[model samples]
Structures are given as structure tokens and as C-alpha cells.
Target: MNTAAWSRIARRHPSAFLLAVQLLSLMVYPLFDGLPGGRLVFGAFGATALVLAVWVVNRSPAVNWVAWSLAIPALLCAVSAAVFRNQALLVTASLLEALLYFYAAGALILYMMNDNRVTADELFAAGATFTLLAWGFAYLFVVCQVWYPGSFSGAVEPERARTWLELLFLSFTNLAAVGLGDVLPLRSEARVLVMLEQFAGVGYVAVVVSRLIGLTILRQGRDS
Candidate 1:
């Protein structure tokens, strides 16, 4: 496609782009995660996702500058953490990333709830918001694990700190209200966070998703 075509698509479907990159990262992550020379690659992927998230936020009702402000420091911290392998930097990055994701999720939610008309982008935004919430909680889980070592226990390595993917799996399970898998939160703080995520997951479906579905049904009925 031409540049204009790509730009048009981006303008029309910013949320779709954000959702695509995030889902694509899930597949690409395992390939680079925990392997030699993985940090640099992972950092690149993270930076790309952050940029896309900022773009999506710009399309929302939220202040675009705020997203940029958060993303810049978060990107810097993420790169520094990945390159230096510094635990302190990693913690800071995770905290910043969690905040950024939460902010973006909120923006997308506002965009979706701003109007009754359920456009294609709004539908995509719904899915994107779900992923953003999952990522935010996963990053929070990372910080929680650092603050309280052995916060999570897994079937394979009961004593070791859970991997990023493992934490993400736990986050997804909690957010989707599915039963927890191998990774279990053992600490009070971790359990509390998990409970909050469970509520968020249920509430998203009950509120945002149901609203979208109802609106779509209403629109279809009017057309028919």
C-alpha cells in the first residue's frame, strides 16, 4: 500500500494498530525472551508498542501530552533497564510502564464510551483496552514480585521468581476471571492486586462490552 493508504488506515483505525502490535508482541515475545541478546530485541519491541500506545491515546479524548510525558520516561527507563540489567531500573521501568498502560487503557475506555455509535475503531478499542489492562496488571505484578520476592509460585520452579510470560499469564487469567493456572500469587499484596484485576475484568464486560453490544444491536435493528 502507498503511504497515503497506510496513513488513512492509521487515522481511521488507530486502535486496531495498537491492538495488532500488542497481539503480535505476544507471539514475538517468547522468541526473544530469556535468550541471549534478547534484552535488546525485547526493548525494541517494547519501544514500538509504547509508541503505538501513545498514538492510540492521541486519538482518544485524553490529553495527548500526558501520554507523551509518561511514555518518554517509561521508554528511557525500559531501555536503560534492558541494557544495564539493573534491578532498580527494571523496577522503575515496570512501575512507569504499568502507569502508562493504565493511562492508555483509560483513554481508550473514554473514547469507546464517549458516544453511543459503535464504530469499527471503537470495537477494536474495546479489545485493545482489555489487552492494555492485562499488560498494566502484569507490569504491576512485576513490581510486586520485586518488592516481595517469591510473591508468585509456579509448578515448574516453585522457588524461583516467575518469568515475565508467567506473570502475564497470571494477569490474563485474573483479568478474564478464569481459574488461575500454574502460577499462583502467594503474598498478600499480590493477592490483593489479583483480586482488583478480577473485578476489573468482570466490570469491563458488564459495563463497556455490554454497552457496545447493546448499541450495536440497536443500530442493526434500526437498519433492518
Candidate 2:
């Protein structure tokens, strides 16, 4: 496709593209991290995430400068950690990632709230932010595990893929308040964090839906 075509698609379906990239990374990480070119797969995931972050930064007028400033260093840290294979650097990269996603989520939420009429793009952005919340927590859980061993039960293997996928799964389940017995938080800190995530999940849904519905009804009233 030409540059114009790509630009049009991006403009029209920015959230869709962002959601696809994030979901793809989450799904592919565990499945392919065990195979060859694992580093490459990780690099690709980080690249796509960075691209989405840049897109959000450019699209958001008010926070674009802040987003750009933070995103550059986060992207650099991600690349550096992957290249150098430094454990400490990876932790830094992961923390940066969580922060960046939280920022992106805030920007998207701001856009959603400000618009008088909600569009598919806005709804998709909302969903993307929700998933990003889970993603951020996944990274946080990993950090917790790193800092305090046995923070979680049923985490047997030490492989990076296992660690990530397990935590990602746990994060989502906790966020959604749908816990399976496969993994459980053993540490007090982990339990407290999980409670916080659960609260966030419920509160986010309640607020976003109510805000969107209110906006829609107000717009309709004005139109009628």
C-alpha cells in the first residue's frame, strides 16, 4: 500500500490497529518464545507496541509532548534490555512499559470523554486502554515476582515465557475477577496488588460506560 493508503487506514482505525498489535503480542509471546528466534519475536512485539505508542502520542494533542518524551526513553530501554540481555535493564524496561501504557490509556480516556459523540474508534480506544491496564499489571506482577520469590504459587518453571504468560494470565483473571486455581498470589503484596487491579477493572468499566452513555444521550437530546 502507498503512504496515503496507510495513513488513511491509520487515521480511520487507529484503535483497531493498536488492539490487534497488543493482543497479537500477548498471544504470540508465550507460544513462540519457546521456539527459535525468541529474541526476534520479542523485538517485533516491542516494536509494534512502540509504534502504537508513537501513534497515540502524535494523535493526542494535549499530551503529545509528554508522551513523546517518555516514549523515547521507554523504547530505548526496551531495545537495550533485549540487546544486552541484562536482568536489571529488563526490569527497568518493564517498568517503563507499564508507565507508558498507563499514559497512553489516560490519553485515550481523555479523548473518549471529550468527544460529544462516541465512535467505533473511541470505543476501541477504551477497550485498548482496558487491555493495556491488564498488560501494565502483568509487568508489575513480573516485577513483584522478581523482587520477592514465591510471590505466587503454581509458578514452577523458570523460563521467561512461562513466567510472562503465567503472570499475564493471572493479571487478566484478577482484573476480571475470574480466578482459576492454577495460579494464586501467595505473598501479601501480591494479594494487595491483585485487589487493587480488581477494583480498577470494575471501576473502569463502570465509569467508561456511564460516561459514554451520558454523552450519547446528551448529544441525542441536543439533536432532537
Candidate 3:
């Protein structure tokens, strides 16, 4: 059904609904995948689906950006697939699905935090910690492809293994002077994701950081 139905079902059949979404989202990589243009159309729907889920389940701006941040890679894959008509996009598509699920779980964390007020330091710490962890994981994946070469499928043909990692890391990094040039996305699809993530990363920092910082400063001023 729709988001309302899914959220309600989540209350009673949470596991079932979660499993269904998660399972359906996963796709095979480096093979003959679906058409790119069609995938983009699907990506738009997926984005809407995710946003709806986030809105219906629990609307936290922080969590929304986090989920959108994750969605970037998948949307990139869909775009890449549609634009270039390549199968390599599926690899990143799978990555997006994983990110989506984790961010979706983040919603629950935000909900839990609602009960106990978390400080700015706490929020910053949590964000930074996750950012670092995500980067490390992405770094390892990219480095593996770089050093091993073909260790990951679609690393050579599309040659976007390192690039994917870079985009993924940028998605989590959230900074003004991001991108050190060590990881540059080469392919069309990877580049699309890089641009989108950079835009998103900047926007998230501007909005979330300012608000969070304002709240933190206010909290500290009040408490002090």
C-alpha cells in the first residue's frame, strides 16, 4: 500500500514489512541489469518511497538528511544505468539499498533520543563517529579495489571502484573543503553521485550544523 499503511503495519508487523522492503531493494551487481532510463524512473519512485517512509515513521530532519545522504548513491546508480546503459550501476545500487536500511534504522535512534535530551556535543559526537566509521569502511572497499584490481566486480570495466568509495565517503564527510583527490569518481554514474552528494553534504552542513550549533550554544548558555 502507501506510507500510512506501511507505518501502521510496522507497528504490528514491523519485521515483515522491514524484511519485505529490504529484500526487494537489493540487486545483483556487474551483470546485465535493468535498463538505465527505467532504473532512473524507478529511482525517483524509490526516493519518494523512502521519503514517505521517513515522514510516516518519524520525521527528523537530521534523520531525513542521513537517509537522503544514503539515497544519493542508489539514485546515482539509477541515473548512471539510465544514462549510460551499463550494468556496473547495479553495484552502487546495492550499496544504496544498504545505506537506506541503515539510515532507516537511524530513525529509531532519533526517536529514542527524543525521550532523553541529547546535548550538541552528544549529537556532534554521534554524527562524527558515524561519519568516520562510514568513511573507514568505504576507504577499505575502495583501497581494496585499487590495490587488488578487479577485487570488486565492475571495478575495471566501468572503473569506478575507488570513485564509488569517494562518493560514499563524501556523502558521510559533510564539509566545505572536502575531497582530497585521492578518490575521484571516473565514470559518468559515479560522477553524478559525487556532484549530488557534494551538494547534499553542503546543504546538510549549512542547515543541520547551524541549527544544531545554535541549539547547542543556546543550551550551553542557558545551562551555564
Candidate 4:
């Protein structure tokens, strides 16, 4: 309720804050999509998510400067692209963002694996890392779409470049190994990326997530 209470929670559960913001952004995005003010709103959310991600990374074993290095330029490019509608800036921003998300995901993974005992924050990091990977792949899709037009085709507009939401949906589906929906990747490069994401999804669940589950179970057994 108060600043002190919120600060304590954040201090104890940094990953939870990042995870909550990512999920909340998903819900908030649809409202602003395709609107005149959408770019500005998306930029604000992007900046917030980046900052939260950096905070989460700082809590991990990774070098904090790397996260900040990527984040500052990514933020600047995002803002410039949104303001000027520069295609080059957009592509650069997308690429930088993808790298930053992937880096953050890696840091979180390392944090989770660093200890045998799973804490509440580690559990939260698991979910947050998954979202970070999803986001990273989605940004890659954005770059792919720009480089190879018509790479993705959806039921709504088969000829046009897919919206951010559509690309993100595709990314999630592919990463989760779920059956594809109306959106499909038509280009070879896109399909290759999708396949890579599929492998990553399977490996993450089989390795990192399963390890977390095992550790939790082991702890529970010892307590019992």
C-alpha cells in the first residue's frame, strides 16, 4: 500500500515485478494497437519493460553494464523510430531489443541454475525468462518481416506485413510447440527461425524448467 511496503516487496521479489509488467503489457497492448497514439504508448511500455528487465538482470550473475549498454541504445532507437517513423531505426531497434531480451533471459537462467534451492524469486524468474525468450523471438520476427516482406501471412490480411501482436502470437505458438494458428511463416528464413524457436522451447522445458521442478521436489522431500 505504501512506498516502503512496495520497496520491500521489490527488493525481495525483483523477478516477480518484471514478470507482472510483461503480463500486464500483453493485456494493455491490444488497446493501443493501430491507434494514432499507439507508437508513443508502445514506446513507453517498451522503456518500462527494458528497465525492469535490466533490474532483473542486475540481480543475476551477469554483468549489469552489458544490459545497460544494450538497453540505452535500444531505448533511444525505439524512441527515435516511434517519433520519426524511420524504417532503418525501427529495424535497428528491433534487432537491439531482440539481443537485449535474449541476454536478459540468459542471465535469469543462470540465476535460477546458480542455486539448488529454489526460492520464490527463482520461481518468478522462470516465468519471466520464458516471456523474455518469447519477446526476443518476436523481435526477430519483426526484423525478418522487414527484410523479407510477406514472410508471415495471416487470415486477416494475407498480403500485408503482420502486426506486432500477430508476430508475437506466432512466436508464442512456435516457442510453445503448439499447433499453428491462422498466421503462418511463408519464407524459408522465417521458417528456419521458427524451427529454431521450437527446439529452444522444447529444450528449455526439458532442461531449465525440469531442473527447477526437480530441485523444488527435492527440497520438499527433505522438508517432509
Candidate 5:
């Protein structure tokens, strides 16, 4: 094909990829509870990210090669998460996905850093919207279980109820990688999942935050 034809084929709209990401995320929200369904739910999350990566690799210009290289490992991690029935595997897969998303998010942010097509405020708003949407779905998953009864005890053998407050506290702890022992995961799967989340959480902070900090310091030095 001609060079012009190739260029046209490679430049897909970013919205197409983002929509795939959102659909995959929608599939993950319901599957957090300790059950067979939860496994499938999280599987979808990784799958969606994988699909987005593929689309990005095919379309994103000269950068497509680098994106493909990083995306291959990410998609493999997603496949591993999908195939493994172990709870730990699922959690690990998610942690990997979290890390992959961290990289993806950074790439997007850097792409927009100087572009006038979207304002920094607009980008921040978009990020917050996705975060809130994810949080809402996760909450609804728990509430629906409570509104109806669960296959397993919501809390534990002796405890009668599962509080959103407690779940939130643990979720943040997992995100922050500061595991306090009080809210331990009872199921083996949950434990595996938590460990993956913890690892991803720490690694993400280490990689992404440090990069952003360096960017800021460089910006300051340049300004001065």
C-alpha cells in the first residue's frame, strides 16, 4: 500500500480505545465478592485492557512498536489471570493490570501535557470521573449482596454483617500497601488478590510517582 494509505490506517481515534477500556472495567465491578462470578468479573477487566492495548498498538503511529512491546507482556498477564482459577492468580492478574494501567495512564498524561486539544483541568476531570465510576460499581456490588443474601457469610463465621466502611478501609490499605492485620482476608483467594494488589500498589507508586516527580523537578529547573 502507499505511504498515505498506511498513515491513514494507523491513526485511529483515541475514543475507540478508551471505550473498550470502559466496557472492560464495567465487567470487573461485579466480580469482587468471593465467588466464581468474581473471577470472571476481574478477568474481564484485564481482557479489556488487553484489547485497548491491541488497538493502541495498531493505530498509534511511530510509537506503536514500543506500545506493542509493553502491551504484549500486559496481555499475557491478563491471560494468566483469566486461566488460573486460584484466587491469588486472579489478584495477581489484577495487580499486573493495575500496573499496566499505571503505565497507560502515564502515557496518556504525557501525551496531553502540552496539547491544547484538552486542558489539564479537563484531563483531571476525566480521570476523576473514571475513578468515581469504578468506586460506585464496586460499592453497588457489595450493597446488592447485602440487599440479597450471599452464598458465603458476608463477614465471617461469627460476624453477621459486612460493612462498606470496613471494606473501604481495607481497600485503601491495599491500595496504599500498608496492610494492617485487623482486616485480613479470610479466603485463600482473597489473600492472593490482596497480595497482588499490594505489590502492584507499591510498584506503581515507585515507578509512576517517581517519574512524575522528576518531570516536575525538571520543569522547575527549566523555569528557574
Candidate 6:
């Protein structure tokens, strides 16, 4: 689509397109999980979606640097996986993805918190940030598995799709503080990371709720 089309959609709904892409990715990812080059394709799609989402939400030229930084590593990951055939490439990709989405989540959360009145855009941004947090932790778990063998009990082979999927499943469960016993963090560092993610999840809900309620009350008072 052209810039004009994107601009029109963004003006109509700031984060709706981004949220739809994310939901679509979540829904379709399982179909491609086992196929060759599937991860890279989805990674590229997700990176592009995230960059566009940030652009739609922020509309600042300064954020272009961040978008480019995120996109470059994703492109490198595709090339590295397809051409070089390196297992290390997955590790690099995971790290890059984790950092990029973490930054995106932070930016979105900051934007939501700074708004004087909560709008639909802010609500969508908040949801996006929550999803980004889950994704970031999933990638972080992948990195830990790469660095320290047997960091997770159920994920023996770090490079396989099954292991990656398991880590992602565990990441979301941990974020929700579900504590399902199927996957356990064996390493001290891994456990620490899980704990931190759990804390972050709780803290995020608290902060976001407080901010929204505070803003709503302030808006009502001003109108009164």
C-alpha cells in the first residue's frame, strides 16, 4: 500500500491495523511453525508490522531511526537463516527481536501514560504493549536457552521449532503467573527472568488501570 493509504488508515484508527496484524500473526503462526523458512517469513512480517504500528502511533520523524534499527536485524536474520544456514543466527535474531519489541513496548506504554485522557488509540497501544512484553520475554527465553543449555527442562534442543514454541508458551504462561508444571526453568538466571516478567505483568496492569481511572476522573472533573 502507498503512504497515502497508510496515512488514511492510521488517521481512521491509530493502532487498529497494528493490532489486527498482531492478532493475525498469532492465529496463523502455528500453521507455519514447522515449515522451512517459516520463522523467518513470520519474523519479517512481524517486524514490518511493528515498525508500521510505531509509526502510526507516534507520527514522529525521530522514531524512524528506531524503526530502521528494528527492521535491519530482522532482514539480517532472514538472510542469515536462509543463506548462511547458521544456528547462531536464531540466537542473534531472538536477541534483536527481544530488544526491538521491548523498546516498542516501552514507547507505547510511555505514550499511554503521558496522555491526559485515555482514548481508543491509547487502549489499543496498551494492548499492543502487553503483547509486545510477552513476545519480548519469549525471545529472551530463547536467548537464555541458546546461551545456557538446559536452562528449561522441557526444551532440550534449543534450535528446534518445538523448543521455541514451548518457550513461547511458557513465556506467556509465566507472564500470566499461571505456573503450569509442564515447563520449568532450571537455571537460576532463567528463574530470575521468569520472576521479573511476572512482576512486570502485575505492575503493568496496576499502573495502566490507575492511569486510566485517574485520567477518566480528571476529564469528568474538568467537564463538571
Residue 134 local lDDT, model 2: 86
lDDT of 3 at 69: 67
lDDT of predicted model 1: 0.92
The residue-by-residue lDDT of candidate 3 on 36-114, one tens digit each, is 4444554554555455444423434354566666666666775676567665665566556545644654553354245
Q: Candidate 1, residues 1-224: lDDT per residue as tens digits? A: 99999999999999999899888888888888778788788678778889989999998899999999889999999999988899999999899889999999999999999988999999999999999999999999999999999899999969999988899999998899878689999999999999999999999999999999999999999999
Query: Comparing candidate 1 with candidate 5, which one achieves the higher lDDT?
Result: 1
Task: Quote each prediction's TM-score.
Answer: 0.97, 0.85, 0.38, 0.98, 0.42, 0.81
Q: Is 2 or 3 the stronger prediction by lDDT?
A: 2
Estimate, for each residue in 87-154, the C-alpha lDDT of model 6 and write its tens digit.
78878877877877777777777777774777877777777777778888988998897788777886
**lDDT (Cα, 0-100) at 55 in candidate 3:** 42
Off by over 4 Å in 4: none
The TM-score of candidate 4 is: 0.98
Which residues of candidate 6, in runs, are more than 4 Å off? Answer: 1-7, 53-57, 60-64, 155-162, 217-224
Q: What would the per-residue lDDT of candidate 4 be over residues 1-224, giving only the tens digit for each residue?
A: 99999999999999999889888889998898899989899789889989999999999999999999999999999999999999999999999999999999999999999978899999999999999999999999999999998799999979998988899999898888879778999999999999999999999999999999999899899999
Scored by Cα lDDT, where does model 5 land?
0.47
Tell me the lDDT of candidate 2. 0.77
Query: Residue by residue across 1-224, what tens digits does model 2's lDDT show?
Result: 99999989889868778888888887678777667577668777876776686586566544677766766777787788777877787788778787777788777777777767888787778778877788888888877877777788774553333367778888888877775647778789988888889998888878886788787788789889
Question: Which candidate's lDDT is highest?
Answer: 4
Candidate 5, superposed: residue stretches over 4 Å from native: 1-13, 16-20, 31-38, 53-63, 86-95, 119-125, 128-224
- Model 3 residue runs over 4 Å out of place are 1-96, 99-176
Instruction: Quote the positional error of residue 144 for candidate 5 in Å.
Output: 27
**Candidate 5 lDDT by residue in tens digits, 94-211:** 4444444444444543443433344333233234223322332233324333444431133354255444435544555666656453455555545555566567556555754455
